[model samples]
Target: MSGERAQPVREQGTEQDADVDADAASTEPEADTDAEPAPVTNGAQSVVRALENAGVEYLFGVQGGAIMPVYDALFDSEMTHVTMAHEQGAAHAADAYGIVTGKPGVCLATSGPGATNLVTGIADADMDSDPLLALAGQVPTDFVGSDAFQETDTTGVTRPVTKQNYFAGDADSVGDLVGEAFALAERGRQGPTLVDLPKDVTQGETDHEPGPARTPDTYRPAERADESAVREAAEAFAASERPVILAGGGVIKAEASEELRRFAIEHEIPVVTTMPGIGAFPEDHDLSMEWAGMHGTGYANLALTMTDCMLAVGTRFDDRLTGGVETFAPDAEIIHVDIDAAEISKNVQADYGLVGDAKAVLDQLYEAVAPTPDADEWRAQCREWKEQYPMTYEAPDDEPLKPQFVVEAVDEATPDDTIVTTGVGQHQMWACQYWEFTEPRTWVSSHGLGAMGYGLPSAIGAKVAAPDREVVCFDGDGSFLMTCQELTVAVREELDITVFVLNNEFIGMVRQWQDGFYEGRHMASEYGWMPQFDTLAEAFGAQGFRIDDYDEVADTVEEALAYDGPSVVDVHVDPAENVYPMVPSGGDNGLFALSEDQL
Candidate 1:
C-alpha cells in the first residue's frame, strides 16, 4: 500500500489520471471488468486532500521518517512544499505566511525533536493571535506510552499553545480532523491549531474523502455586539470632552483598519495604536498618535493617560500597553471591544465591553453615535505632546552608526507597502519607532513570545507569500545568530529578502534593562566575540555587505536591495546606545523615561 500512488479526489476533474490508468490497463491483462473497484485512499492522501479542499497553496515543513508518507503523498499534489532548514524555521515561515496572506499557514514536522522544535513558533502564534495550523507526525498508536524511539506526546505538548488540538484516532477520520483543525485555526479570534498524525494512521488505508473545510457545528463566534451596550458606549463618547480610539492587532487581523480609520476620523477622535496595531491608522494622519505603551510614543501615552472616554477596539490591553492597570486611563470610562469575550477586561477593567467582530462593532458605533465629540482642545494638547516629546535621535558623523539611522535608511530605500519582519530585541523596537507603516499587515514580529530567531525565516515566508513585494527584515545581532542557518534555505529558494543586522555587540535590550534597573551590571548579555555577518551571509550564498560608517550606509543599502536574491547588510552600531521612551515594568505610561538618567 505504501508503494501505491494515491488516487486523490479533486474538485476539478482528474481526466489525465484516468487516461494514464487506461493506457496502463491497455498493455496489461485485464479481468473482472464487471466487479466494482476497491477503495484506494490512505490517511496521508486524505490529509493532503483536506488541505487541497481548503485551498491551501503553500506548506512549510521538514521531511522526516514519521512524516514521509504524507510527504510522499504531497509528491502528486499541486501545493508548493517548502523544505526548511529546521522544524522551527518551518513553523516561523508558516506563521509569517499566515500573517501576510490573512489565512491559516500550514506547517508540518515529525515526532519528538521535530515536534518540540516547533513549540516556539506555535507559542508565538498563540500569543499574537495569528492564524496557523501545525500537523505533527507521531509514532505508531501501539507505541504511544511505551517511550518508543523518537516518540513524544505531541498533542499534550502543544495543547496549551494551540486553540485546539487532536490526535488522529484512525485513518478514516484523520482527513476530517485536518479540515476541522484548519477551520478552527482561521475562524473567530484566529490562533494556532494542531493535529497529531500517528505513523500507523497515515499509513493505514481508507476510502473516506474529507469535505470542504468547516468549523465544528458548535463553534460560533459573535459577529455583533449587544445593541444596548453599543448605544450606551456611543452616548458616553458623545458626552465626553476628551475621546481617544485605541486600535490593537485585532483591527488588522479582522480587516477593520479602514473601518477603524473611518470611526476615528468621523468622530474627530484621537487615534493611538498598540504596537501590534501600528498600521491600523496612518501615522501621518492628524489624529494619529502613532502607538502607545512601553517604548511607545510619549504623545500617545500622554493621550491615553489623560483621556476621559476611551474606545479600545480589538486590543487585549496587555501589560505592555497598559503598564500599571490602575494608572492606565484612570480618568477615563473605557469601552473595550474584542472578538473574544474572554479578552474583554481580562487585563484592564472596562466600563463598557462590546464583544463582536472588530469591523462589525466599529460599523455599529459609526451608525449609533448621534453627535461627535468636541475635541479641538484635546487634539491641540495631543499635538503639543507630540511636539514636546518627538521621536528623535542623533547620529554624529564621527561616532558609530545608530540602529535608528539604519532602520530609517531601510525605510527610505524601500517602498511604503514593503513588508517588514523583525526578530525580537532592541532592533525590533528601533524598527517600530522609525519605520512609517502606512498600510496594514506591513509589520510582522514576535510580540508576546518575543522569540529571537524569527526574522530570517519569517522573511522567507513573507517573500514567498508576496513575491512581488519587497520583504525586509531588521534583526539584532543576538537574534540573527539564533537562526542564521536559515540563510541557506533563503539562498536555495532564491527568495528576495534583505536583512539588516543591527550589530551592537550585545543583547541590547537586556543590557539596557540591566543598566537602568540592575545598577549597570551587565552579566552575560554582552557578546564578547561575534562573526562578521556580512562574511557569514556570503558563506551561505547570499549577497553580503558591511556598513561600518554612516558614509557607507546609503550605497551599501542600494547595492543590497539591488541584489536579485537574499542579501544581508551588517550595520555596525553604537554598543553604548539604548532604546528609550521606556516605562519601567508596572510603571505609569505617562511617565516614560527618555534616557537612562530618567529611569
Candidate 2:
C-alpha cells in the first residue's frame, strides 16, 4: 500500500547560536535528591519514568541478571519491551524503529556479552546516522574496574560509535541521563548514544527529576543558508545550462523531500539520489534519474558527469559518490548545500557552500530563484542516455529463477503503501532500482556499513512502529542465516510481515565482485551445503514456501502476502548472477561496466 512520507519530531528550545559548541554532548551527571519522587522510588523506577517522559513507546533487547532491577521497574510501565532473540537484533530493531517513527529508538541489554553484542548494530547506526538510544546494565559501581560477573565497559566500547554516553552514578541521575541520552541521539548528526546503569544505581534509592526539555546550546545545525550564499547559488543555478540535483540522506533526515521535489520541478532540473537518498524524489518523475555512484543507474552517473551545475544537497561527497575528486562530474561546478559546514569542501570542493537545514535552504532558494528553462538540449541528452542504457537484467530460459525478476514481481504485487526493507548487497541495489518509492521513510536498509543481517530485524521494527502499514523484508540467503531467528518474535508477537529470501546458494555480490575484479578466483563464496530454508521457517513457527521457477513467483508471493501471519518465501535463484552497471573501485564514474559481461 502507498504510505505517507515521515515527518521528524522536532525537539523544542532549539535556537541558533553564533558560537556553536563543536561537541555533540558532554557527561551529564547529578546527585541532587532534594525533590521527592512520587509514591515510588528507586533508580530503576526513575529510569523507566524518565523513558516515559521522553515519549519512548517500545524497547528492544534481551534481559540478564545485572539488569533485573530495571526489568522489575518495567514490569508496571506502559512502554512495551520486545525481547529479541539476540542483542544485535535488538539494536537493529531499535535503529529501524527510529528510522520509521522519527524518534530515538531505545534498546536494553545486560552488561558484558549483552552490551558487546550491540556493537555491530551500534557501528551500523553510526555509519548510517540512525538515531538510537541504548541502555545497558552494568556491574555495581564498586566492581566497575574489577571485572565482576557480566560486567563490561559499555560506555567505553560504545563511545566510538555513539554521539556520547553516560555512566549513571546514583538514583537521582538515572532520569536525567535518560533525557540527555534522548537529546543527544536526536541532536546534530544523529547516531547511537548510551547510558550504562550500574546495578547499584538501579538498586539505589533517592529523589529524581526528569530535567527541563533539552535545547542543544553548542551543537545547532544551520537552519537557513546565509543570504549572500543563497543569492550566489541562485545566480549559479540561473547561469548553468545543464544542472542536476544530488539528493542524499540529509533530505530524508530534514524531511525536505517535498521542498526538494518542488525545487527540482521549478528549475526543470533532473534529480539523482545518493544510495541512502533513493526516495528523495519520485523515481517515476520525468526529471528523476534513480541513483548515481558505484553501482548506481548508468544514466544517473552519465547525467552527473555531463551536467554543468551539480547542486548537491545534504550529501557528503564520499568516495562512493565521487570515484575520484578530479574526475567526478568533470564538467560541473558543484554547489553544495548542507547542514554540516565541514562537509562543504571535504572531498569534492564546491564552488559555493550554503550550510543550512535542507528544508529552509530549499525554501529560501525557491523564493530567491525563479523557474528558468535553459536545458532543453541537456534534458534530451539525459532521456537518450536512459533509453540507450536502460536498467535491464536477463532471465536465462534454463535457469531456476532470476533474482531481479523475483524483486520486480514482488514490487508489482505489494500494496502501494508497502514499506520495503533489505539486507546489503545485490538485493539492496535491486530494491533501490526496482521499488518506486513515492514517499520518504518507506525504504529502509543498511546503506553505508552494509550490514548483512540488518534486514529482518529492521523489518520487525518497521512493522512494530507502524502496525497499520505493510512491511516487506528482502533478504539474501546468507544474510538471512545470520539472524533469521528473529522471525520467531514475529510469530510470537503476531506481527504482520513477509520476508522474501533470494536463495542463490552463494554470497551473490561477493562472487560477482570476485569474478570481475579478481580474475574469477571464487574462494569461500558459494553456500555449497545449503540449509533447508523452508524447514528453518517451520522451526520458527511460520509458513514457508519454496519455488523453483518464475511462474511460481506470482502465485507464491500472492499466497504469502495473503497469509494471516508472517511467512518466508524461498525462491531458488541463479547462483551466478551479478548486479550490473557497476563502476570499478577507483574507476571514473563516467566509465561504468554496464553488466556482468561488459567488464
Candidate 3:
C-alpha cells in the first residue's frame, strides 16, 4: 500500500513521518528535477527576473544604446516591457500604473538624456506621493567621472526627487539594489526610487549566487489617526452648518472610497475632490462635487469660500486647488489629514492637522460622529448647484468630430471599472470634464507636472496593471504623435487597450490661447502634415478605425473595444473646439475665462 512518494522522503530525510514518505515516494525525481530554476543570467536578466518574481508584470522605458542589453534581456524574459516614445512618457506611464494598482511602477531609462528626461515625471510622482521604481542605465564604470559618451551622474541628478537611489558598483549587487528600490518606492509616504546600473555591470558576469529576496527590516506603515484628533474633527463636522469634505489623491492612495462614502453619508456633508482626486467619491453620489480649484465647478468653489469648516483628506491645498493662498477658503476652519507630515499646513493654514492614512483617519471619524439621518437643506443646496451646471456636451452637426462628444461616447461605451489615462492638453481637460468617474484611481494623468505625451504610454501601463480591465487613452493628435511610437509596444505585447486619438491636427490647447490671446497667430501649433493615424495603427499591426461623422463615434468605439488586441480610433475632431472655463496660468480661480464674452 506504500506510495511512490515514500521513497524520496525516506531516502532524503529521517524516517519520522510515514505519511510524508508515502507522498514523496509517489512523485518522480526526474519530473520534479526538470522544473526550470531561476536563470543564472546577466545582471540585466536577473533584474528583470527579480521584478517578475516580485509581481511586477509591466515595465515602461525607451530603448537607448546604453540600455540595449537590458532591453535584450527584457525581451527574452516573461515580464511585459512597454517601449515609450520618450523617457518622460515612460515615467508618467509608470506613475499612473502605480497609482491605479497600488504597486510600485517600474520605469527604465538610459543615462544622460534618458535620465534627464525622467526628471519631471520623477518630481510629479514625488509631489503626489506615488510609488515608482526608476531603473536608469549609466555609462561603463570605467567612464565614471570622465563624462564619457551618454554618461550622467543620475544618482546626483535624482537625489532630490527620489526617496532613495543607488549606483550599482558591480553585477552582484544589481538584484538586491532593484529589490531595495521597489521596497523604498512602496514604503510609507511612497515616492520614486532610482537604481543606476552602469553598462559594465549590466553586461558583466558574477560568480556569486543570487541570494534569497530580502524584505526591508524597517518598513514604516502609514500612520493611523489618533482618537482625540478624530473626535475633534467629528465634533466640528457635527456643529457646522455648511461643512464640506475636501478629498484629495491621498484618499485614492489610501483606498478610502468606502470609508469616504460612509463618512459623507453619515454626516450629511458634501464631498469635493481635487483634480487628481476625481474618483475618490462616487461621481453619481448626490454629495460628490469633483474638482474645486481654479478650473473647478463654480458651486464647489463658492461652497469652499462660504463653508464654516473644511475636512481636508489626502490633499495638500495646492495653489491651483486653492485659488492662490489669499482667497482660498477664507471663511472656512480647515482640518487637514494626510499621511505625510510635510503636507500638513504647507499652503493654507490648517486649524487642526492630523497626520495619518486617509482611510484609518476617516474610519475613526466615522465612529466618533454618530450618523445623521438627513440634511435635507444642505443636500438641496448641493443638488441645486449640480442641476445648474452638470457636465455636458452637445453633439454638433459639423465636419469634424468634437472632442467632448468623443469623450462622452468613450465613457459611455467602456465598463464602469475601465481605467482612463490622459495626456496633458485640451483632450486631457475634455476627458476630465466629460467622463463620469465613479471609482477612485480609475482616472490617471500627469496633474502636478502637466507633462505632455503622457496618455498613450500611461494607457499601456494601466493595461498591464489591470490586464482584465479595459484601459482607454484620451489623446490629442499632437500628444498622440508625441508618444505614438508606443503603439508598437502595445501591438507587440498584444495588450487589449483602446487609444482614442482626438485628431484635431493641432495642439488644440495652445492653439486656443494663440487664437484668443495672441492675435490668432498660429505659429508652431499645427500638425496637418502628420501621418494618418489610422494607417499608422494598422502599420503597427493593430486594428485602426476612423470616425468622420459625429454619429459614428459610439459605433467606432464599440468596434475598437471588440477588436482582438490593441486598437486605435483616429477621430478627426474639430481643431476649433477649445477646452473652455480655463483659469489662465498664474490667475486666480475667481478670475476664470467664462466664455467668448469674458474673452
Candidate 4:
C-alpha cells in the first residue's frame, strides 16, 4: 500500500479505459510547428549594434563580471575586440588610436576598480582634446544605491573629465544613449565621452533597434567665424612688421595643417609651433622656426618673445607654452582663433577673437588680406638666432652615450612617414627636440596631463591604427618602468613597434630640477636598482637590444627597426647631461637659462 501511487481526493473514482483515453487525447491541441520563432534580441546586442551602425571596427577593453553580458554579445559580432591586460592600457591605446585616426576611439571597462583604472587615460585624452568614447559597466539597477558588490558611481567619477556623460536606465533606451555618447565624443571641440551601463539592463531582452549614432538635437557648434572679425584680424596681420604665426594642436585636429602652412608661406611670416603643435608645419620649410615654449628651441623662443604681432590659432596658450603670462608676447597684439570660444581669452587675452573651425577661419583670413606684411628684417633676425643657438649636443667617444645621438640614429634609420610616441620625462624632451616631424598626427604624446607610462600603450594603439606605417616610441628609464608590463600586450598582438629607453638610472627630469632648484639634493628621484630591460624584453617575447656606447647606436637601431615584431632598445645615456634653454616655472620666457649656471 505504501509503494502504490496515491489517487486524487475526488468524488468520482477513476474509470481507465483504452477507448476513453484515446478519445480524450485526440481532442488535445497540437504544437504549431510552422509558426515563426521569436526574434533573438537583448540590451547587449543593441549596444553592439549601435557601435556597428557607427562603423566601429575595433574595441579595446578588459573582461569582468559587470561587463560580461556586453563581452558575450561581442562574441557574435564581427568587430575585433582587444583584451588588454589592464583597463588603463586599454584607455591609453584607445586615446592613441583616436589621435592617429582623427576619430573617436572606443574603450570599455567594468564597474568599480575596473572603471577607476581608466581615469588617468581619460584625463589625458580630456586634457589633450582627443576624441574618445568610454563604456563603463555598472551594478544591477535595483542595487544601484545599496553598496552592492563591485558597485561604483562611474558617471559621477568621470563627469569632470568627459565632455559629457550619460547613465543607461533601461534596456529599451540604453543603445540610443550609447549612440549619443559616441556622437558627442567626436563633435566640435572633440573630447572623451562616457556611458554607464547597468548589468540588469545589458542582460535584459529588447526588440527595439537603435538608430544611427547622433548628437542631441540641442547640441550645435559654430563652424565658421564672423566675416567682420576675420577681416579685422587680417588688417592687424597686414599692418604688423614683426609678426609670427603660432600653430597649436588644434590645427592638426581640425586637419588645417596645410591651410596653416599655406597662410604662413603666403604671408611670409615665420612659424613657431607649440610642443603639441609639432608637425603642423613642415620643419624643413624656410618659414619654420620649429617649436617654442619651456625647453623649446632657443631661436623659436626668441622669435616669440620679440614678436610684435602674433597670429595664434587653435591654442589654449597653456602655462608651459607661456612661461610668464605677463611677458609672453608682451609687445604683440594677439589674434587668437579657436573652435572653442572659451579659449579665446582664458589664458592670454586676444585682441581679435575668431571663433570657428581652424581651416575655415584660416581660409577666411587669407582671403581678407590683400598683401603680405614687410618682415624681411625680422626673418633675417630669426635665421640669425637659429645660427646662434643651434639644437646640438656633444658626444665624445670616451664619455657616456648622448641621448640625442640615439634619437638621431633612430630617426635616420626610420622612414620619413614613421610615427613617433613618447612618455613624460627628459627622453620626451630629447625626442621633441631631436626628431623632425613633417606631417600631422606623426607626433603623439601626453601634453596637458603629462602622464608617465603613456608611451608603450600609445605605441600599441598607434601601430594598430596605422599598421602599414612604422611606429617608434622614446621612453625614459623612470617612465618605462611605470608601464613596462604593456610590452606583453604588444608582444602578444605582434605589433611592429621599436621602443628606445633612454636609461640613465634615474628620473632624469626630476634630477635635473633638483640640481637646478633644490641645491643638488638628490631626493627619491634616483633609482637604487634597475633591471636589465634587454632581458626583460626577451622574457616578454620581444626582441631586445642594448647600446652602451656611441658606436653601437646605429647598428642597434637598425636591428631593432628591422625586427618584424615588437622590439626594445635600452640605450645607456649620460646621466649628467641636462636639457638646456630652460624657462623655470613662472619665469620670463625672454630670459630662459641656457645652462644650470644661468639658472
Top of the candidates by lDDT: 1
Q: After superposition, how far is residue 505 of candidate 4 from its true place, in Å?
A: 0.7
The TM-score, computed over Cα atoms with residue i paired to residue i, of candidate 4 is 0.93
Candidate 4, 522-558: lDDT as tens digits: 9999896788889899999999999999778777888
Model 1: CA > 4 A from native: 1-40
Give each model's clash number.
0, 7, 10, 0
How accurate locally, in lDDT, is each candidate?
Answer: 0.91, 0.84, 0.79, 0.89
> How close is each model in CA RMSD to the real structure?
5.9, 10.0, 8.4, 13.2
Model 1, backbone clash pairs (residues 3+ apart or across chains), number: 0
TM-score of each: 0.94, 0.92, 0.86, 0.93
Tell me the spans in candidate 4 whose CA falls farther than 4 Å from its real position.
Answer: 1-40
Model 1 clash pairs?
none
Please report, as a residue range, the 10-residue window in candidate 3 with the lowest summed lDDT: 1-10
TM-score of 3: 0.86
Backbone clashes (count) for model 3? 10
Q: Give the TM-score of candidate 1.
A: 0.94
If ranked by lDDT, best first, what sequence of candidates would result? 1, 4, 2, 3
* Cα-lDDT of candidate 4: 0.89
Write candidate 1's Cα lDDT for 79-149 as tens digits.
88878889999999999999999999999999999899999999999999999999999999999999998
- In candidate 4, position 351 carries an lDDT of 97
